[model samples]
Target: MAKVTLTNMCMIYDKENNKVLVQDRIKSWKGISFPGGHVEDGESLIDSTIREVKEETGLTVSNLESCGVIYWFNNETGEKYFVFQYRTEEFSGELLHKTDEGSNFWVDLEELSNLHFAEGMDERLSMFLEKEYSEGFGSWNQHQPGKLQFQ
Candidate 1:
C-alpha cells in the first residue's frame, strides 16, 4: 500500500521591512525553508499551521491566508505527501533563542531566491510575494531522488 502524509508550511512575512522568517533546515532535509512541521493525526490544518509556527518561531500567527495544497507524488512507487501552504503577516511574540528544527532567521524578500532552499521553496516564495495576498495552488511529481517534475 502507498503511504500518505500531511505537512504544513507558513511564510511569516514582515511587510514593512520586506523580509520573511525562514528556517535553515539541516535535518531530514537540507537547505532553507519556512518554519513548519508535520500535521499530527486528527489535527486541523489551520491549527497545525499555527502550532508549528509557534513551536518553531515562538510567534503566534493569525490572519493566515491559505496559499493552497501541494500534492507530492513519487511517480515510481506511487507514494505521496500533501503539504498545506500558508502565509501570514499578523503575529505576536518574541522570537525564540533557538529551535530544534533548525536555525531560524529573517531573510530579505529580494534575496530569498538567491538562498539555497529545499527543492521548490524558492518558486513557492516567489509566487507568494508576486501575488501579494493572492491564493496559489500547485503540484509536482518525483520520479527519482532529488529530481522534481512540476506540472
Candidate 2:
C-alpha cells in the first residue's frame, strides 16, 4: 500500500520575446524543465508555482492560467502523484539561480525539441505551444491495472 503526492508547475513566458522559458535541472532529473516544483501541504496550486518559480529562478510569477493535470505512478514504490500545469504569459523580477535545479534560461519554440528532455516531455509541450489557440486543461494518467484503487 503506497500513497500519492501532488505537485504544481508553471510554464513562464518571456516578457519581451513572448516565448516560454525552460531550464536544465542541476541537482537531478532528466534534462530541462519549467520553473516550478511540488506544492506544499498548506499551499494552493497558484501559490505553489509562484513560490517554487521564485525559489528556483527568483522570478515573480504573475497572471498564471491553469493548463492541465498530470498523473504518474512510481515503478519501484507504487507511489502515485499528480501535477498541475500552468501558463504565465506575464511576469516581473529578475531570474535568479537559487539551488541545484541548474542554470535558468529561456528557449524559443524551435529549440524546445532540441533540448535534452525527460520522457513524455514533448507530449505536453506540443499541446501547450500548439497554435490555433485551442486553450484548456488536460489530463495525463498512468494507472496500474492490477493495483488496488487508492480510494
TM-score of each: 0.84, 0.77
Q: Write model 2 residue lDDT over 100-124, tens digit each, in one string.
A: 7888888776677888875555556
Could you tell me the C-alpha RMSD of candidate 2 in Å? Answer: 5.6
List candidate 1 stretches off by more than 4 Å: 132-143, 146-151
Per-residue lDDT for 22-134 in model 1, tens only?
Answer: 89887856789888889999999999999999998899999888876667676666667877888899988998756777888898888888889987776666445655433
* Model 1 TM-score, all chains together: 0.84
Query: Per-residue error at 101 for model 1, in Å?
Result: 1.0
Where does candidate 1 clash, by residue pair? none
Candidate that scores best on TM-score:
1
Model 2: per-residue Cα lDDT at residue 109: 61
